[model samples]
Target: MLDYSVRTATTHTPEFLGLPQGAWVQEGGPQFAGQGVVVGLIDTGIDPTHPSFADDLSTDSYPVPAHYSGICEVTNDFPSGSCNRKLVGARHFAASAITRGVFNASQDLASPSDSDGHGTHTASIAAGNHGIPVVVAGHQFGNASGMAPRAHIAVYKALYKSFGGFAADVVAAIDQAAEDNVDIISLSITPNRRPPGLATFFNPIDMALLSAVKAGIFVVQAAGNTGPSPKSMSSYSPWIFTVGASAHDRVYNNYVVLGNNLTIQGVGLAPGTDGDSMYSLIAAPHALKNNTVSPTEMSLGECQDSSRLDADLIKGKILVCSYSIRFVLGLSSVKQALDTANNVSAAGVIFYLDPFVLGFQLNPTPMRMPGLIIPSSDDSKVFLTYYNDSLVRDETSGRIVRFDAVAKILGGLNPNYGNSAPKVMFYSARGPDPEDNSLSNADILKPNLIAPGSSIWGAWSSLGLDSAEFAGESFAMLSGTSMAAPHVAGLAALIKQKFPSFSPAAIASALSTTTTLSDRQGKPIMAQRTYSNPDSTQSPATAFDMGNGFVNATAALDPGIIFDCAQ
Candidate 1:
């Protein structure tokens, strides 16, 4: 057994920004605990012992256990030569090694044990045992669990341990899942680049998705994390439920600072009093500290021992440091400062921004340290003016002030950045048209729905962040549409739990029609640009980017209009 710890159960419930929490609970909870549904998850396999789905397995074949009904469609070889790094242990490799009659071949195709933790994390979220004693990545495990704890799950090993797999294998897995009579199919994988002559191979996958849809099996796919762009993977497929990412909070505690040289007359400046404040002070130029090199031409060793950073150089004076400088040193510098706060105390660390990089701050782990980031353009002018004029005094203030960084539950729709406010993540792929190449004007007619993906906290492997190089881990925070698809799959289980009579198309319809158009900011969620043509008349509101806003489980369960596809 790999030494893995469980994540702490979050007190906050996941919510769709701009969507009502009450509606979610009322519609999804009461209607869909997915009583008799069996969902087939095709990707990396699941850890059968995970707590969330402890009760979901069954040894008997037909008339499966009430909670679940399926078997592991074990197809690939174990411990093949290619899988040396992914599948550890001689025991896991025994079967494959014996069958191949050679250790080298065994290493090439390792057994279905998850070398990359992605499959396990997705599985746990979709339908793991409800409770367990595992702690990982600061998360503890217990009953506060997946969307469909009672739903049964079937695992398929399609993607290889090397993170690549034959497309044919995937098509086979789909056929197997369908033959197994799975009520839903969840796929989080995508092609690296469209395979050469992709349409030929893709036609089958496309047909598989449509075939699943026709079989009354709801198919949920990740919208891919290739961001700032609208085109991402099979997300364009019309028959499949495509999901995008959104921030969990409506308001983020982000700050906009002005420097001493900038005009500060209108803004307040009483140290910490004004949310945004600027001051005029001469400080060290650029020097590295804590293994970090300055953005300008300077080495880490030279900067650490340089006299420019001494108290004499910065004492009682405001210092400006560029954010770009820290990357050279890594986040370890931040951690070190927090660890040694009492030993080597400083006034504060102010970050100067550079135009080349957009500043998107991650939630700091060591909660109690003060740091601030200023835009590069703003910081440059301040630096120049303060350097030239010794008597320059700058002031600044703003409504956007730093708030304690803590994850919180955000409900309903609002677009302002505030504490724990949800927004569409910077990396979530957008859509203007569905895969069918239809030109529907509204997102409600296209891209379709949203789900939980992007920086999602979940199960991790024991290897830790540094060791687990691939996308999934024994435990860690992962971002991408891959994370989101499972959430929808789990919800599909819930939908089946409530309306056993509903067809997959009806379920997809309920999910689509119930989606909200406004984002956390209350602005209409729209698709990003799909083509370079400047005259493109399509806006974000049309079927281009925001397919029907995001998925709303609550509304879907109680949808007023159910889609009735023509037979």
Candidate 2:
């Protein structure tokens, strides 16, 4: 009865894993890129219209898997022909939420159409069509492709946007997905709380998934997002393959240059201020409308209140806003600030880190207008000092001010590569596995593997129920262990397609053993500790931080040796 919320692209999936399309083969056999496999996903619903889920990618006619008997639930929103060859099955289970009187039909679509973008994102990351243009805010970051683009996706919408979901509904979805004879099942969700000792394995969801394993389905789950702490794993059952989140080499960098010629690099997916011309810069508080009453920091510093802003003062200028604690608490957002800037006819925006808000990692949030965020408190201090010194206020009343601060935003559309990556993300749950509620530890390793989960770009639902910033965006960038699990699931499909007779345990063994321990820089993989503002503190990761290490999909194709555990 607890609600669980929702949690991309540039791992160059096929290329980075060394499983280049049509080139990676099993010994002397045909290409085994998940052609005949079916991946079943249990989460929020999916967006049928997304090009990632479209069936017309290949010239050769794609057909539904003969062994898969799953059906698409047709409704007004999810009309006929929603299921194509690529998306073979789609269904939603909300009876439990309805009985609990928590299901809202409008927000949580009654059909398999995803209102929350989580399911669509996860599904596309696993088995969406290959090489779909990933455009957001009129910028093309890159083309996105699933790990197993040739595989079919079967979606079971058990979780909703309003209320995460109930165990009964989740279990029901699992039973049906298993009955449908899916080759793999990917779960991007974690329980809000762990069950007591020994009951963890006996829980309805685990037990049903265990049954699926017996029936030859590979199960993969996220190793929860609460991490950098020991024994924080949510998926503990040894039968399930748990995945942790890791960083990839790809990164998008946006920068701002002050009139004083100080260029500060930051994160933002937005356009640049009119072609290298530094615009008139003014702070949000200084741009408040004449006679505006008693404005708080939320309204004046963070630019959350558009009504308080003076259009005349803000027009054609780059407004400075504070990235405050309210932003972390969900009371304020970068999107709202952007909207306010647009409403006031501001040319662009620049956000400085509020020293009060500490230890939070800022992802590259998308913006329609030209903008950038200064993530480092040190850089923010530098920028603020310059701005304050440049201000010319009236000596008598301190009311007649002349705005002199100026800066220009550079285009943040391009991506940069060659970052030392595959390092365990700070939020990817760590483990020596948890034993019980008393906080005892188990001997078995929890996260069977790690995969690229930070700053992943994938298809997004138009409804965007969980994220207001990406409401109408076709693609979004997100980071979480939830984003890591489907990667292993899709890779599992590739292994299954290659070795048709391999048991689930054997496949897991292949994935677990065939991993690389070094990063692109030829150094040992590191783990983020999340103790400081920039959160860049790192140390060589332990087995618990990155179990067995980062997955190498091509090496997994021919592991040379595989352990066959009797189920």
> Best candidate per TM-score, number?
2
User: Model 2's lDDT to the true fold?
Assistant: 0.83
Alpha carbon lDDT of each predicted model: 0.47, 0.83
TM-scores vs. true structure, each candidate: 0.61, 0.93
After superposition of all CA atoms, the RMSD between model 2 and the true structure is 3.0
- Model 1 per-residue lDDT tens digits across residues 160-189: 443245445567677777766778888887
Could you give candidate 2's per-residue lDDT for residues 24-135 as a string of tens digits? 4552222235778999999888999998888774456566889999998899999999888889999999887898788898888888999989999999888777778888
Q: For model 1, what is the error of residue 49's alpha carbon versus the real structure, in angstroms, after optimal superposition? A: 6.1
Q: Which pairs clash in the backbone of model 2?
A: 8-456, 8-457, 9-457
Per candidate, the number of residue pairs that clash is 77, 3
Model 2: residues with Cα > 4 Å off, grouped in runs: 1-11, 21-32, 57-60, 196-198, 291-294, 436-442
Q: Cα lDDT for residue 463, model 2?
A: 74
